[model samples]
Target chain A: MFEGVPLTWFLIVATIMFFIGIYGFLVRKNLITILMSLELILNSVNINFVAFNKLLYPQHMEGMFFTVFVIAVAAAEASVAIAIIINIYRRLINIDVERIDEMKY
Target chain B: MLIMRHELLLVIITVILLLVEIFLPDNRKHTIILPSILLFFIVTVLGFIPGPTGELFGGMYATTPLILTMKNILNLGVLIIFIQSVNWLKKIENKGKIGEYYLILLSTLIGMDYMISSGDFLMFYLGLELATIPLATLAAWERFKEKSAEAGVKLIFTSALSSGILLYGISMIYGTTGSVYFREVMGAFNATPLQVLAFIFFFAGMAFKIAIVPFHLWIADVYEGSPINITSYLSVISKGAAVFILMIILYTVFYKIALLWRDVLYVTSILTMTIGNLFAIRQRNIKRFLAFSSIAQAGFILLGLIGQSQLGMTTVIYFVLVYIFSNLGAFGVAGIISNVTGKESIDDYDGLYRTNPLLSLTMMLALFSLAGIPPVAGFFGKFFLFTAAAQKGLYLLVIIGVLNTIISLYYYLLVVKAMFLNTSDQPIAYFRSDAYSRIGLLMCVAGIVIIGFASPVYEFILSLSHGLY
Candidate 1:
């Protein structure tokens, strides 16, 4: 079944995942949920990279190298973000983004 | 081997600073200063050493003299930020995280250096994401402040959106052209409609980082909510580095589509200037006002990009250097004033000249420079920008740019008028800056004045742009 999948299928799946991430990012009220959306978007990017690596440039693993770096950085980013979110929770007692509008005009 | 040694030295210094901060007591963590300064010196020296602009890691990493100069400028900016933040950091109740702040800032700076020097798209995206994600956290460093949290949310959302668009554009380009290296893309581009569409998407994403109009809504709120130091970093260094990279990428990858982008940029220039100025006119919050004005200045930089000539690159880089000092001077003054009065409104600046003549004069010079008035670096910056635009026969864009400069002067002068002209109900208390911030501000003021008179600096920038392409 996987062998029958065309390159266009990979693009379509990636696009779907990207849009879902966007939707979650826009609709979610909690900071953590929004961060998860960001992660999903990143994962979609990784999928694109791997797919292109497999199909377009099999001789070189440039896309795979980028994917590894992206994963590593995303891990670092998520840890820092979670720490900040926890700090915000301690201060405000909630993670709802709408309630954090104290700075907006 | 020598270049690798230099890179290794930088890595060691950065890691050692990080480790030293982890072990130090909260109060004594100020000792991180010695290493920070040492790292700055090392990076500066490394930046000047002549080396071949060779590709590393199978053509992914590339460095040139121009990229080295850009890195040096960013290092200098980060050093100033470190010095400027000393007092501001001391004032924070939660001082334990101070070392972490420096570490993150250094990492972001490293990422930016890589971003500008990157010849391949893979490294470019990696560097961009690394530089940006930390800034979103920095926006909310004041966890107790609700606005800070809001700013963080807005920044992350916008960044995620733009990243998605940028990624899609990158994928499309790869699909159509079968390459991710910039030079390869340029070699393969046929000016197809799909390629143009991809370029537009990529440009739009970059425009967000530069905070040009229509992509600028988050800027004012983010600047207001973030710690003043971080806001200064975002407004000047972050945006400036992005523009530097964008200029290089466009010059290399999309020279074939210059005519199309020039027309698009011409209209963007007018709209950005008009909108940014009109919005700036109505802002009461000083940070927000400067934020919009910075957006307008981004539009002016876009005018330089439209020229797409060697002179245009020189003008853009020169203007960016002047802008670094001018905007940082303004923000530094704002930071000092906010520390003292806890007020951030234009009206609250009433009778500031009476309270503190030195700060008032410094601020006046900064504002004058920002408005492109005579005898200040800002004037020369705008003059070069207009000259570059006019060289491209973008007479209409130049006319609008000049007119917008005049409109911008009105609002900038309003702050001056408040400080010198308006009467106060209560005497504004004069506050003293620590030795470091004072020196930083003095250096910025000195740079503004001296760089204006220094013709060789302009010539150097022109030669550097020629070297870049």
Candidate 2:
């Protein structure tokens, strides 16, 4: 079941995007950037779901439905994350992950 | 309707709480507490009623005797938390937001209920998000507190990240199998390289929720920063729900790769148990102490899972039931003390027995239960888990589990020693916990004392788990 754009290409791009997300998550100092990285990770997964559905299994709509649910859930998660970020900014006057360690062992 | 009775009733109660809050005046915000607990208590009791059990919504939602029992266990734990939190919620600092707290908590419970009953990964994803996102708000409930806000940020960030990984794994599973339904996926699953990678991602995401070793860093801070009641909810109810779902999925959907996952569990279990025990040893803050101990408990739960049969499922569920009682008892005493005295350190607990003998006795029983000492429910829980693992002939893992149990006993005894043996000039002053909290603690104590000697409870779980594998 070959197509104009191969499934391997899509998988490669998603993998790259996913790893970039992992990198940003580990390296980012600011909370909003980390949040963005999370979105990147999720969006990459959405790409994988969509491509896998269209390319590998066109007869099934489950992956498409899953992608839609994921997008909706990711939005909700982003709103909650931003609320938390704004709250952290209000309380600590910054959203730097390094400076937020008040309860370390 | 019959299948989702638990979630439906919980949602209705949340709406009732919300409407009641709007009608009630400001000074009487505390009144919502009683109604919330009463309504939730009714829901908990009603959950045990025999009901229709089968597939729903094109097999997206399902329930069985085992799933009903799991939901009932979660309901019972949340009800106790509602009762235990009454005093904290009544504080002036919490003021008008009391209704929102119950609503958010109820939503999370609903999420968990759906997650537990999910027949398809789509429903599971929705329930997982519903269960998780509100909890971030709860972690940062005290938005003005720096640590609380930090905890919220960390929790949301990590949970979002983990869910993303989990979804990616689900995408792969869907790609390979062309279905997200558990039954369909299980039939098509294989030990292919990509499927193995997908399983690992799925396991890691779940490990984050369960607070296994690699993903447990966020737990201590979150537990300490959140309100004491939220902390207990996270550790007991939230963790229990995740464990139940993970066990179900592993035993069913991933049964094709049991050997692969068992090896993974064997390594992670040892790391989780040893690391959790070691970190728990030096914690000064009681919340952090319990945080690490609960992580260790999660590790022990893995031993039961590694057994990989009907007996494994039985022990894991049984242990979780016992754990909820034991851990909640410990946190109830700690919460009451913290709420009344604002002293949260081990040092502050010195000479506690002199002033408050009953609280001290409760703490001692809780600690003993945690240490898996004979006569309490935790010992029986651990004993059964060990027996299940040994039945599978995982003798070396059992030995390490036993060793970790010893290490855990020492730390638990340290708290016991502080409360009963250590002396200090300025001990916490005696104060009576509210009647509601006393009732909650009493329930926990009763559960801990009674569950061990009750063979019928084990038999019931075993019977329910008979066809799980």
Candidate 3:
């Protein structure tokens, strides 16, 4: 019922998840791992949306609708992105972003 | 009801085109072009239809004649990109994906159109994400190229970070204002510290898309790595659309805090111009150089925003229109040369005039326009921007803007000199452009020259700004 916990707790949890995703994005070398981190980041966004939908505007479900759309789009994006990553690996045989700096100054 | 019909039409056209692209035979994939052109033409016509500005979906969606105008300009730019890309797409190894590329580009364009019309924070963020993620994929569409992959990674990472920051800002604003509607947020704006912090975060996120100074590192690298056609999309249409939305949001929602944000913009504008031009001067790769040049042009556009007047809005719109043509022309020429030689460096252009006078002349006109030479739209573009800034009593910004213009001229001339003065060791083979690309370049050239002299074009822009408020 979330009776004891304040609404801010949900935001704090979302923020923590968001930061973890950012850390993974910066640290991970594998392309797929970095992509997983991006998913985590997007999930944190969903958490915020759900929390706001419950706490701020209980009468309207617009935030919930937005979260649903975000999830659908993220799934589509991840599928296409993974396919591209696989193609890149087949061509180049690696997914290390650092070594892929062929066009860097 | 009319606006709704217009939006519905665009959505239907986009979905139909996407389906046809997905199912079309590879050899017959050129069929997608007809639908795209038709859709763009329809959207352009719809944009001109007069109607009342109002809200939909419980005030989350808003539309005005000005937003329609912005959407139409973007559609026009996208159509130009499609035409210019056809020849370049034919040369790429995986030519079949050209249809998919157009689809993604159209979908992203739709997102931008919605973003400009969104009246609430939720829709705005969704639109931003939709517009950004596909672009990241487009940057790396060349699966075999390591540079392309790196560009995609960089873009996605930066985009994710900015989205997080922007989300945090939105949360903060909601916490303080208890609402995310633009008008509601405007009513709640005060000198509160939370409001200031939220504004800073919001500015930083939007600044990343606009490629302001501190956030511009990804631009040149991405431009160099991406295919020239996609780079053209990134440089002109994507950035221009973001600036349009930013202008609307800042002017409508955050106008009361203009005094605070204007100071932030002033410092950022000067830094963006100086840094962009300074680095642009040293780049050897034509794409990278133009990347920085585009960043510097963004700073000039920001100068217009600092004016905070109807004149400023009109100037910004006009400059962006001119920029769409000038920048696209430059990239189109670069695309032609790059396709032929697989070379993007200034050195490769030596004796270009001797090899292919027509290509060289187009390149010359593009660069001259970019340098703000007379009889070209870029001159009028910069003139209007500086005039807007001067009206705001921001004379120092205008002076720096002019100095930066001169600095830009030096580098652009360097490319011209290479093409005209130096001789190559081997005779460069004359490259041929397909009918579509040639028509595209001709269209851009015509836009640059004729639009420069056309008073009615300026008048239309003024009328659009008048409708904004």
Candidate 4:
């Protein structure tokens, strides 16, 4: 149980993970690494949703439903992302964001 | 069940299309195109039939006349895109995958319908994800094209990042209000610091989708790389859907924080308009030019939002409708040219009037409409949006809007000049556009001309906007 763990603690962890994900997203070059960063961002939000549901409003399952949907959607998104990464790799022989500037303004 | 008639019809059609896709031979794939368009046409027509409107699934999904109207507008845009894409779909490179395009396209439409109808955060997120993920695949549609693949990657990356940010905001709202339902959240929402932070995140995420200035970096590249058909869809249909939902949420759920969001809109609108116009002036690729122009259009739509009244809502919706016609008209011409001649740069369009006078005319009309010139629906749309803002005593924003309109007219005229005034040693040769493209262009022209002169459409939208807030 999450008893005796203050909500602020969970909130603190999620916030850190979210920023770390954003940092990775900005700093990383490879497509898959950026995707992993996206996952980190999503998972951190998942943590926030779960902690809020279980701690703040124990009666309603709204946040729980939201978490389930997020997990499902994130999985779907990851699959799509991988498919796109593979497609990009095939066409260009690399997935580095730096190298993928074929259509820049 | 009746409340979501539009979504239900689209789902049925999608299922039928899937069944057809399963049974059809790979070589015979293009056979599905006509039937798919015909079926979707029926669904688009069915969407307009008056239907019962109310909540279902425990207040998660709801509908209203205004929502119905928005869905209808989207359906109209998709129908035009479908018609216009027939020529592109018939290409040798796109031969075998025609059915897949229709199926994916329909599913995304279904997603947008649900997104527009969503009454809760959960439904909204689901609809939003369903709407977006497949679009990345479509962006990468020409898998053999290097730029298309890159577009897919960029689109998916930015969308995933934006959605993550948006979900984080929703989680915060959930934490603060203890509910995700819009009605409940609306009652509980206040201008607390955490709630305001949540709103900023939500706005940023939606802004990325709408391609608002600060978050608009992904747009030009994605638009330039994707096929012209997909670019137009992204600019008009996808962005329009995001704006509709954002407006709905801000007006209904975040009305309590009006003062906060108005300030945000004011700053973003100015930056979005100025930056979009400045960048638009430099773009040579027609798609990227329109991309920046659409960003400026989004800024203008924000002026309507800042008004924060029924008139604002009406102008936003009306302007979006007018925008669908004008933007698509411009893109349709560009698309047919690109498909036929493989030329997409503004310089390539020189002396277009000498060879393809009709397309040049269509492009001119569309560009003029986009610049808010008189005798077009766009002028009326802009006039009303300015009126809405001026009603709110935001004269400064309105003036800035008018100035931007003039600047936009200048750049738009540059394109017009290339077509009409500038002579090229080698003009694009005349070739008649196919039947479908003509029909598509005709529809857009008809909408542009009729929607402006016909006062009933505006009055109808005004009536629908009255009780929405």
For candidate 1, list the clashing residue pairs, or say none.
A103-B147
True contacts kept of 1: 0.34
Worst 10 residues of 3 chain B by lDDT: B1-10
Clashes of 2: 0
Off by over 4 Å in 3: A7-11, A43-77, B42-46, B49-53, B467-469
Instruction: Show model 4 residue runs off by greater than 4 Å.
Output: none
How would you encode candidate 1's per-residue C-alpha lDDT over A39-69 as one tens digit per residue? 8877887887778778877886767776787
Tell me the docking grade of candidate 4.
Answer: high
Q: Quality of candidate 1's docking, in CAPRI categories?
A: acceptable
Candidate 1: where are CA atoms >4 Å away?
B1-10, B49-52, B92-94
True contacts kept of each: 0.34, 0.94, 0.26, 0.92
Candidate 3 lDDT over residue span B293-379, tens digit each: 999899999998998888999889989999999899989989987887788888888998998888888888888888899888889
lDDT (tens digit, per residue) of candidate 3 on A1-105: 775667789889988998898899889989899888878877887787778778877876756776787688667667756766776687678988776677665
Clashing pairs in model 2, backbone N/Cα/C closer than 3 A: none
Task: Give candidate 1's error at residue B426 in angstroms.
Answer: 1.5
Winner by lDDT between candidate 4 and candidate 3? 4
Interface RMSD of each: 2.3, 0.9, 2.7, 0.8
- TM-scores of chain A across candidates: 0.94, 0.94, 0.91, 0.95
TM-score of chain A of 4: 0.95
